[model samples]
Target: MIRFVVKRLWNGALTLAALVTLTFFVMRLAPGGPFSKNRKLSPEVIANIEATYHLDEPLWMQFGRFVWGLLRLDLGPSTRFRDYSVGDIIASGLPYSLTIGFWAVIVATTVGIALGVAGALRRNGFTDYAAGTIGVIGIAIPIFVIGPVMQAVFALKLSWVPVGGWNDGWRSLILPVIVLSLPNIAYISRLTRTSMIETMRENYVRTARAKGIGEWRTIWRHTLKGTLLPVIAYLGPATAAIITGSILIETIFALPGIGRHFVDAALNRDYPLVMGITLLYGGLLILFNIATDLVRAWLDPRLRHDG
Candidate 1:
């Protein structure tokens, strides 16, 4: 177990290193160097500004400084928000993102799994058809489309909920979270339906039936237990996707989250904030994946014993 965990941690470290390097070069490659304005600038002024930020130094030297900062957990200053460091921006913004992402995951996973189980159990019936239709619509509609229509209907037309803001007492989050979760709900539901259906046909399920076990008990004990593995595996990637997808969702809703920060950083070419946000998100994904893998291995005894 120690060896396995160590291996996962090593891989995660390598992935982080590659991501940082790639993000640095890619951002640098983009035109305008973070301070290029449409307005004309005097030569001495430009030199002074460049010198102030050490952009005067060679790229290799800058890269070295970046690596040193990484080792010290110091995300550099933001280009757009001159007074704030990248770390400070993240510190303030992460909570908002977490709040939305947490609610989104809960709603998505719970509904998806339940509807999927019901659809599988009632295969070829109305329940299955309804579930499948809902899933299709969720998958087809982008969050951008869903967000506006929902805001128009619920907030504009009905005035039932605020269009956006953290002050709406959880009600404000209803639309955004639903829109954010729609795709994930659809995908997980489909996965769960298929997995449960397949598990229901296994020899153990047949054995349980032959033993005269109650229907609910047989399903809860056998089918669900087996189907859990795939669901667990999907969750890791789903979480990463959900958080990244929020980059658009938060921007549309005008929520103060890391996703929105990422958008702002991109437009302004705020390299530190952009790269910091990228690394933070990447680290979360790696950590989630590793956790999911460990849980899967724990749940499936064969995994740990296998070469």
Candidate 2:
């Protein structure tokens, strides 16, 4: 287990290095430099700024310097936001994103698993039909549409919830979290239903039934052992996405999150902020992937022992 963990950590570090290299150069290659604006910088000012950021150096040399900074755990100061460094910008925005993201995943996983289990147990009955229908609706509706409809009904028409603002209490999050999780919940429900159906049909399940295992225990324990692996596999993507925060969702709700911050940064051509946000997102994604891998290994002895 120690050797396995060390190997995974080494792979993760390499992946992060590659991601940082790709992002740093891609940001550098975007049409405008950090200093580009409506009014061109005077030649002297341009030269000065370039020298100050070491942008005057050859691209390869500057890239080397950037990697070194990353190694030192310094993301450097924002060229546009005078008071902030790249790290500072990310630090400030992460909490809001995380807060909404946590509730979103909880809603998705709990509802999806319960509904899926019900759908499988009921087969073609009313519960199965209802779960399937709701899942379809959730998948069909996009977040952009869901966000407005939620804002309209919950915030505007009924006024049961505020339209936006973190300070407005947790009620402010309900609509956004629901909208964000809806699609994921739908997808997971479908997976669970299919997995449970197959697991229920297996000979082992029949043997369990013959041995007089209760119906609930047979499904919950014996059948569910196989079902969780698929769910965990799907969670890696879901985790990364939730952490990114739905930019559109954040915008529609006027939430102060990394997603909205990065959107605002793009409009303003804030290079440092843009790089910082993407890097932070990439780092989070790597961490989540590592976590998922560990979880998968833990859940399956074959995988754990094999690796």
Candidate 3:
């Protein structure tokens, strides 16, 4: 177990390093400087500003300095928001992103699993068809489309929630969370329903039924544990998608989160902020994948022995 964990950590570090290197070079290659929008600065003033941020340095030197700063956990200064460091800006927005992502995951997993189990248990019935139809619709529509339609119905027409903006507490969070969770819920439900249906046909399930075990008990004890493996595996990538995809969702809802900061950083050519947020997101993806592997191992003894 210790060896497995160490291996995963080592791989994660290498992945993050490659991500940083690639993002640093890509941001530099893109046209436009962070100061490009400044109104008519004298050449000397522009040079001074560039010097202050080491932007005037050779590309290799700038990369080295940035890497050195990262070694000490420094994210450098934000080009657009000159008053704050990249780390500080990210810190400020982290809570909102995390809150929305967490709730969205919870809702998706809970509701999706229930729908799937119901559909699997009542195959070919109304519940089965309803769940299947809902899953198809959720998967077909993109979040950008869903967000506006939801906002129109719930916020514009019904006036149950604010149209957009993060200042209204739980009511404000509702629309975005639902929008984010929709696709994930659809995916989880489809996966679960298929897995459960297959598991119910296995010999152990038949054996349990032959022994006169209750239907619910047989499913809960003998079926669901194995049925969930695929869902658990999908969750790692699902989590990364939910977090990163929040960029568009945040924009639509006018939420103050790192997703919004990331978009602004990219558009303004703010190298430090852009690279810093990219690294943060890459690290999160690695961490979530590692967690998924660990949880799978814990849930299945075969995985433990194989590892």
Candidate 4:
């Protein structure tokens, strides 16, 4: 297990390095500089701005400086947002993102797993049909469409929650969290239902039942852990994605978060901010993947040897 973790960490480090290198060069090579939108600036003024941000330096030299800063855990200053470091911008927005993502995941996982288990146990019944219908609707409809429709009905018409903005506290979070979790709930429920069905048919499950174990006891003890395996595997990347924040969800709901900042930075070609967010996201993804592997190994000891 230790060896497996170490190997994963080493691979993650290499992947992060490659991500940094590729993003650095690609952003630099893009058609526009960070100040490209400032049409009225004089040539000398532009040169001074470039020099200040060290865009005037050779690509390799700039990369070396950025890497050195990274080593010291400094993400450097934002070229677009004056007087703000990359870390400062992220820190300002991270709380909102984290809050939305965390609640969304919790609700989705709990509700989804319940629906899945109920549907699997009562196959061909109303609960199974209802769960199936939900999965279809969620997968078929895109969030952009879902977000506005929900805002219209739940917020605008019903007045159950505010239309947008973070000022209303938890009420403000309701719409965004629901919209964000909808698709995930669908995916997880479907995945769990399928895995549960397959696990229920496994020889061990049959053997447990044949031994005269109570139906619910056999299910809880013999079936559930195996059923959750695939669900946990699916959650790694999914969790990372939501935790980083949903770009469309943030935009539609007017939530201040890293997702919004990420889009602006990419569009404006803000190198430091863009790189910082990318590295942050990449690191989170790698960590989640490693965690998933460790979890799978714990749930099923067979994986430990494969690792």
**Candidate 2 backbone collisions, by pair:** none
After the best TM-score superposition of candidate 1, give how far the Cα of residue 10 lies from its true spot, in angstroms.
2.3
Best by lDDT: 4
Ranking by TM-score: 4, 1, 2, 3
Per-candidate TM-scores read: 0.93, 0.92, 0.91, 0.95
Which residue runs of candidate 2 sit more than 4 Å off their true CA positions?
Answer: 261-271
Q: Deviation in angstroms for 209 in model 2?
A: 2.6
- Give a tens-digit lDDT track for model 3, residues 21-64: 99999889988899998799999999999999999999999999
Off by over 4 Å in 3: 37-42, 210-212
Q: Mind sharing the TM-score for model 3?
A: 0.91
lDDT of 3: 0.90
Better of 1 and 4 by TM-score: 4
lDDT of each: 0.86, 0.82, 0.90, 0.92
Q: What is the lDDT of candidate 2?
A: 0.82
Query: lDDT tens string, model 4, 88-182?
Result: 99999888999999999998999889989989999989999999999898889999999999999999999999988999989999999999999
Could you give candidate 1's per-residue lDDT for residues 88-143 as a string of tens digits?
98988778778788889999999999989999999988988998998998999888
Q: Which number leads on TM-score?
A: 4
lDDT for 101 in candidate 1 is 85
Give the per-residue Cα lDDT of candidate 1 at 213: 82
